[model samples]
Target: TEIFDGFSKTVSKCKFIPVVCGSSLENGGISNLLEIIAKSFPSYISKKHFKAISKQDNKEMQIEISENGNFCGFCFKTVLDQFNGKLSFIRVLNGEIKKDDEVLIVEKNNKFKVTKILQPFGNKIEEMEKGVTGDIIVLQKLDDISTTYTIGSKDISYTYAFDKLPQPVYSVAISAKDKNTEDKLISTLHKFSEEDPTLIVKYDPETKQNVISGMGELHLEVYFSKIRKQLKLEFETSIPRINYKETITKQVESRYKHKKQSGGHGQYGEVAIRVSPNKRGEGFKFVNSIVGGVIPKQYIPGVEKGLIEGLNNGVLGKFPIIDIIVELFDGSYHEVDSSEMSFKIAARQALKDAMTKGDPILLEPIMNLSVYAMDKYTGDIISDLNGKRGKILGMDPIPGGLTLIKAEVPHSELLRYATDLKSITQGTASFELEFSHYSPITGKLAEQVIEERKKFITAEEEE
Candidate 1:
């Protein structure tokens, strides 16, 4: 029972291949890789292990691979190249897929001709006719098809897809070195995002920065290297920022009015809103209170939208605003100029004002960390986690004398933990993060972060 509880799975697609290559450069060992790839791998048609039994005949039927074409492929990878455009890495699941052949993408509910079908001979691609079922073929120029999309002929029906990849645990903020590279960086990173589903790129409006997050610093570094190759663009990176959240401790109310008169119509909108702290993770809430048409029903969503956008104003300070309800209880609207924009802006300002008085505190992400380490470093690792405000749930020894440890630690503490752990345990320690509930920080530790925030803001303001 203990073994089952502490077990971790190691998955591999094809492990039978023998790897033998010399030199750290020139991309060698690839020759053996190809031989293994071509011969070691199984073909759907030739594989004799698969058998289907029929009840009436009590006989097994083996799907035969003949000259008859049934055109079926399972998507292996999705590539989004800006030049050649999107391509799908497909494995012929059933029949032969050839160049210039018409194929129906059943997943997309559309049909597209195979612009080109190339087989992987090592890394070099070779054009082939009707890649037999079992051959891995490159499906080019299929814009809509994604990874795992099963493409088949109208007559044949068989599906095969790969297992899902692991989730990304590391990420960081990224930006172009120059203004000219902004568009290029955006487009190139998006292509990379499509190629690897785990790689993510997000634009943070508060930070006004492009954040590129992936499995690790190396993962992001490789992307930067590719960006240099793809677009000839250079980049500047910063330490990954901590995802801090702000929450209020008590209920509070605030009101604001925006009225302007210039030439044509006047702008008038008033909002009286109450803010209350919700339980952690509940997120910001909005309520409407209009009895005598003080504010129109249609304008309510406009106000909510504005408040929602700016509710994270406190977010940059590493805090999340949650459980606060706002009401447009009292407000006057101008008949001529009262519009959604005016109300939205008024609502935004009101929320900002209320946030200041809400006594916000920062909350950091907690990770349920499971570490596999040798017994020699167990004491050191546990002590280190405890120093970072981590709580050890328990520890159990595994088959290899490596202890499986469960603990809850803050994300900030584990930024470079992978490297540190490998060093301490001599490449034997490994850990995975499962995001747990967040909690608040106290003492000088919290103060250090506050100072760091001020510096971050000052740097941004200069920008």
Candidate 2:
């Protein structure tokens, strides 16, 4: 009893977490840990109030954590059971809730009845009639309920603040092996994403592949393993291709005339455009500088549309073009032979002609990388990143003899970094990646990217 008192004082006064070590496989010391937690932890009533946002006035407020107040809680975790459907595990912060009570999903403003509340016991659960303050209860059949969602009684109109999810750093292109189960695979992946918001699944239109992204390789593999076991589905996964962009370096003026004379009314249109490099990341812009009705106003939209469409496939590697401005300064049209189609064709040709001479270059996505590893492995980490064309920003010695290494690396070079880092640090290091900006690639690297793009296009055409 004296030792327990000292430990509790240390925890409450110093805000320190007492570590309880035990072997889960052996089930040793488990009961003692549980007893300590139940006895030493402070009751919910002791926590005077919880911070929350009032939805009614969009202001910050506090909700008292007491059984006398209206029921309010937030979902901390979710589980999708094949037999029982979605189960939302909520930590009640205020008041008490009973079966058949209507509660509002604060964020969604939707009401749902408390159908069945259960207390989880390892792999099983036991039904409960009512849940009060500080109780962690699992509510079954809340299909739309997700993790971090705030729930409150009809009278309560406040939501607890939850931390935002981190951005996914690793990705893999996935495809169903059977092809017939593609829809099922996507639907199942979506359901899994709902259970864990960190897992993201989407289709990449540029690469024409379905991609699944998560925290790391292991994080993605766990979901894949679950899908394989639960649905008996076969799937293939590969490193996703980098989404490189194309841009020009110089300005050039070009013109194109489309004339086809075969029938009574032949198609005829001419376009003159000045293509100039815009500021980086400003995206594509179109300007019309025509006067005296050189090109009819009606056909101007067609010319703009043509230039925009032309950007989808740049002259260098067919990647989408960005940060370029196209100005329609001069053009001509025949009264009877000219049409929007003819102008569109001419405008597209003109842009293509200008791009080929404007010194086009490939731009690769740059990622801001932060690596956390032991100081002993810092040298190896720096050397490996330098070999991968990473620019080391700096390194700081953090607590626990760990170093935080920050760097900027190209996305293509990081496709397999998660696996490589594990091997390099023996699973003692971790890293985060976020897109920084697009940087131009030149010389052999640019040539290789263009060549690979050509091969991809040819293979796709053949298929």
Best by lDDT: 2
Model 2 per-residue lDDT tens digits across residues 151-247: 9898887889667678787889999999999999999999888888899999999988999999888899899998899899999999898899998
Error of 1 at 271 (Å): 2.2
Pick the TM-score winner.
Answer: 2
lDDT of 2: 0.90
Q: How far is candidate 2 from the true structure (C-alpha RMSD, Å)?
A: 3.2
Model 1: per-residue Cα lDDT over 1-463, one tens digit each: 4432222111123423345665547877767766654554444554532332333454655545553656667787887655656767887756677667777776556788776777767546678776876678887676778776777776544343346576666666777778887888888788888788778888876456787767766777888887778678877877677767666666778888888889888788888888777777666667787789988887888789888877666743634455566666777787788988888988888888877787767777899999888888999999888888789999999988789999999989887776677777877777788788778776677788878888888887898
lDDT of each: 0.73, 0.90
Once fitted onto the true fold, the runs of candidate 1 whose alpha carbons sit more than 4 angstroms away are: 1-71, 77-87, 98-110, 145-149, 154-161, 182-202, 213-234, 262-264, 315-320, 332-337, 396-399
Model 2 TM:
0.87
Q: How close to the true structure is residue 334 of candidate 2, measured as C-alpha lDDT?
A: 95
Position 8, candidate 1: lDDT: 14
Looking at candidate 2, the ten consecutive residues that score lowest on lDDT are 7-16
